[model samples]
Each structure stands twice: as structure tokens, then as C-alpha cells.
Target chain A: MRCQQVRRAWLEPELSAKARRHMQACPACQREWELNRRLNEAFSGWEVERPLPAEWDRRLQQRIATARTGWRGWLESWRWRPHPQPLRLAAGALLLLLVAGAGLYVRPRWFSPRAVKPASTGIVRDLQALNQNQEILQCPLFAGHGAGDLANGAENMN
Target chain B: MVIEDRLTGRLKLSADVLDADAEQMLRFQAGDETAFEILVQRYRRPLSGYMDRMLQNSPVSDELTQEAFLRVYLSRRRYRPTARFSTWLYRIATRLALNYLRDHRHERRQLSLDQPSPVTERPPEAASPAPGQEGEMLADERCRRIRRSVAALPERQRTAVILHKYQEMDYRAIGETLQISVNATKSLLFRAYETLRRELRDLEEAR
Candidate 1:
């Protein structure tokens, strides 16, 4: 109810009933309220009166279109610089290098080279023999024919 | 339910205010240009109005308003919904406005240190509202005085007042935008109004 409370709570969206009741009884609070109203009115009116230029939206759109990011965005950012800021350019270059370095370090599997198994490494020879033996055991033709005959019959999957 | 609500481009303004700006921002981050356009459509006028109050409402303000949006666009990939989108936006705008003010103030000061500024008889930044009809002139004069008084305030107080009165931001939003506590923001507004009461006492007396 005090004048100080009214003054401080003036910015609150709604006034407390206690503050409102005291403001009605207090002359100084009335003036304070009136001043607040006028200030807000002046500010609000100022905004309403001074409209932005018609071409602002167009200019903004132009800026955005040209600034659509990527290689072109980078070029556009430094595009018209008759005299570019070297520090910024250097920082950008450094960033590019770091990104490239990280990309190289974390190359994905698809980007990685397929290993050449030397065609006859000992482990590969062993695995191939084991695979053939398993297929022979599973094949009914292996019961009545030699492995070479079965191979010809299978046509080596020509 | 992780409750979702329509944004309607209006601030939630509650303690647990849900921000559709975050949703739109996330969409924008994911390459939805339409969401970015929506944000621009929603904010353009309000932001321009905010810059007008802060930058004395001129062509520069309009330009700076676009610059703020542009920065938002460029930073879209980096966008995180840490705070309300509007809060993040006002913070961007306040910085731009304040920087422009400071840089221009410096330029003006440098001009003053020289012989009369070669730029113009009166710099555009210091230009008053235009001439008008008698009633309009009076209103313009009132607005001018109010602007001058507000402009004379320290940057924080002036910013707090504009955000509070013009933007209709609640204390918490204001505090978050300003990176200050709610209590600090409350006290700041209180002190700003006090300063306004003292400075514009003549206008009150005339009334």
C-alpha cells in the first residue's frame, strides 16, 4: 500500500488490489500512474507513427538469398570486399583446415580402402579349404562322386 | 505428454511457458526454410518496433532489424533451444542496438572533437522528429522529450524500460534476455521509472 510499493509494482502486468486501493487515495501515486501511462503512450505512438521503409523486406530477402550458406555463402560474405579483413580471412582458412583434418581423421567405412588379402594369405587359404569341406559335407552329390566330379557338376558356379 | 501448443507467434509469458519458437527453430535447423520464413514474418514488425525505440526509430533501425534476422539465419545450424526463441532474439537485437548506439556515439564524439562535422549540418542520428500539423507537432514534441529522457538513461535502464513498457516482457523474460536476475530486473525497472519521474517532472507539471 505504500507509495514505494505502487511505484515498484507499476511495471507489473496487473496491480495488486492493495496497491490499487492506496493509489486511489494518494495524490502522488496518481501522478506516478499518470506519468507511467503517458510514457507508455508516447513510446507506443512513436512506434506506430514511424513505419519502416517499404523496401526493407526486399533488401532483407536479398541479403538472405545471397547469404544462403555453403561455398557461395562464403564467397558472398567476402565477395565485395575490395579490402578484406585479413584476420577474419585467416580465421576462416584455419577453420576450414581443422574441419578437413577432422574429416580425414574420422573417415567413414565407405570412404576407407578395401584391404587386398594377397589372394593366398595362409589364413585365407585355410578359411577357403574349411568352406569347401563344409559345402562338401552338406552336399548329397559328394556321397557318390569325387570332389572334382562335384565341382564339374556344380560348374564351379560359372 | 511433453505438451505441445500452437505458438500463434505470441509469447507464452508463464513460469512454465512453452515456446513454439524452439519448435520452429528446431525445424529451421533441420533445413525447413519455411520455419525460418515464419519466424521472420512473426518477428519483423515487433523487432523493427523494438529497434525503433532503441535506435530512435530510423532507417538504420530497420537495417539493424534485418541484420538481427540475418544473424539468426546464419546461426540456424547452431541453434539450441536453451532459452525461449524470443528471448534469444531480443538478446541479439539488444546487442545490435547497443553496439550501434555505442559506435555512433563514438563517431559523433569524434566528429565533435573535429571542426563542425563534415557529414552534415546536423547528423541524422541526432535529427528530431519532422515538422507537422499543430496538434501533431505538439504530440511529436512530447514524444521527442520522452525519447530524450529515456535516451539519457544508462544503457541497461533504458533497455529494461523499453523491453518492459514497449515489448510488454515480463520480469523473468526481461531478466533472461538481459542475463540478470528477476530481482535485479525488478529493481532496475523501479529505478528507471524513478529516473523518468525526476527527468520528465516538467511534462507532468505542464499536464
Candidate 2:
């Protein structure tokens, strides 16, 4: 096996028998094994000196307080803000005024009375005008009829 | 006030019965703000250490750690109890670290500008070594060299090493935090170890 492969295999939790044999026969692979072992040992024994800062708690508290007072606090407060009686009353009055104004503006246009002429009155006016003008009764249909007969005929037609 | 005390007592009892971290998170979700402080106190040290190792800057680590906690607080309402709290917490921290590393690669050099440089004097342990102290100095030097070597690694490899070695996280959990598969996590760790071994091989020979 290549020394790189052997080195990688050595780092694994379980080394194969072939790799073990290679490590034994190959001095380079053995050195690689030793290096890997040393590295692991160093890692296992690695220590860090990490002391918390003196103002850690204070800084954190300040950060939390800032967060509480920032946008999130504003949003939460807005969500839970109380709606007062005066505001509700004002809103209702505004809605009622809007409805009244709309009805007043639209009523004349929608429901106004129209000047309507009856069909019978128009026919009666035309017949009376024809009776007053005897020339229009000189037609053959009224040849032997007087104004009385014409009126009687007109009534019958009606 | 009596009812409030009874409710708090019930919450505390339930929190004690369940997974501590998840229970605290649930309490925070239920509007118990004090429960969030408990979580912050629990994770502060480990998370700060992890960030320091990952970024190699104490101040940046501190800021990122606090930001991670703040993000947790902001997301309390959306939290679910389906997963381990540490896993979720680490996921947030890792993401923040990775993003900071990516955006601030150039700015990283400036992180140490404010700190006093270490070149003025050596500590007694490092200076005028006694016969028996030679080995101790060598060990300290080797450790410093190892830290430099680890820091010199590429970002992904260094993350893999820090998560696997320093954090003692399993391949599965590391994969989950890194948003990669188990095999990918293994490969990353192997490559990282290989690099570390190559970089620190001279230290082994010096011994």
C-alpha cells in the first residue's frame, strides 16, 4: 500500500491486518504511524486557558436589556396595547357619518320620481283635437257620422 | 400572586422532569424570561471556548457567542422540542462563526490590533529554563506550534478539527451542524488530521 493510504488507515479506529503488516515492513509507514500517534496524543492532552471576562454578566445583561427595548419589545407592546372606549366611539361615529353621507348623495340619483304620461290620456287628447278639427273627420270611415258618432266610435275603440 | 407562584412551581417541576435544556427553552417560549438566562449561563463557557478555538480571537468569540444567545432569545417563539438543544445551539453558533469568517476574512487581521503585543517579555516558565524545565518549555513551544498549525488550516478543515477534537462531537452531530453528510464529515476530519500531522511532524521528531 502507498504510505499515504497506510497513514490514513492508521488514523482510523481499527487498522486492517494488511495495513499492520505494511507498517511493520515499511519504515516510512511506521514513521507515519508514530506521527499520527503523537498527534493524537497531543490533541488529547491539549489544554486551553479560558477565563471568563470580568464584565461578562454585565455585558450580557445590557445586551438582553437592549434586545427587550428594541423592535421586538415594540412589536409585543403594540400587540397588547389596550383599545380605549373613546377611540371605539369615535370610529363608530365616523362610520355612521360615512353611511349617511353616501345615502344622501345617492338617494336622488337612484330613487327620484319620473315625469310619466299615461297611454290612455295621450289617446284621449289626440281624439279631442281630431273632433275639434272637422276636416280630419271627413275621411270615408266617418263619412256619415257626426261628431257625436265619432265620439261614440272613439269611446267604443277605447 | 399566589396563582403566579403555583404556576411557577409547576413549571419548575416540569422543567426538572424533562431534558434540562429543552425544558428551559420551553419555559422561555411560555414567557418565562428567567429561563433564558439559565440557558445562557449553561452554554456561555463552552460556546465561547468553541468560538475562540474556531476564530483564534477571544474578543470576536465573545461577541459571536453573545450574538448566538441573542438569536436564540429572538427565536424562542419558533423553537420546537424535537431535537437536542445543544445541537440546535451549536448549529446557530457554527453558522454565525462561518458567516463571520467568510465576510471578515480580511477584517480578521484587525481583530488583534487592539491587544498588547506579546513580544516584550517572556514569562518565567519560558525564560532561563532549569535542567528539568527544558522539557516543559519544549512542550509549551510544541503546543504553541501545534496551535499555529491548526490555525493555518483551511477554514473547513479547521472547523472539522475543532468540532471533532475540541468539541468531542460525533461525526453525525458534526455533519448535522455543518449541513453535510456523515461520510463528508469523516473525510473533512481525515484531511484535517493529515494536514495537522504534516505540519507538526517536526515537533514529533524533536522529541
Best by TM-score: 2
lDDT score, residue B73, model 2?
A: 78
Model-by-model DockQ, in order: 0.17, 0.15
Ten residues in a row with the worst lDDT in model 2 chain B?
B114-123
lDDT of each: 0.74, 0.74
- Return model 2's CA RMSD, one decimal: 13.5
Residue lDDT tens for model 2, B58-146: 78788899888887877775665555678789999999998888998887566453332232113335259878988767665555666
Candidate 1: segments with Cα more than 4 A from true spot: A13-26, A49-51, A65-158, B1-18, B107-140, B204-207
DockQ of candidate 2 against the true complex: 0.15
Model 1 chain B worst lDDT run, 10 consecutive residues: B114-123
Cand. 1 TM to true fold = 0.60
lDDT of 2 by residue, A1-158 (tens): 77778766753679899888887899877776677776776666556457778898788788878987899655543342233357756876899999999999999999898987766788899987888777767878678889798689789999
Off by over 4 Å in 2: A1-6, A10-12, A44-46, A72-158, B1-19, B109-128, B203-207
lDDT of 1: 0.74
Provide a comma-separated list of chain B TM-scores, one per candidate: 0.75, 0.79
Residue A115 lDDT (model 2): 84
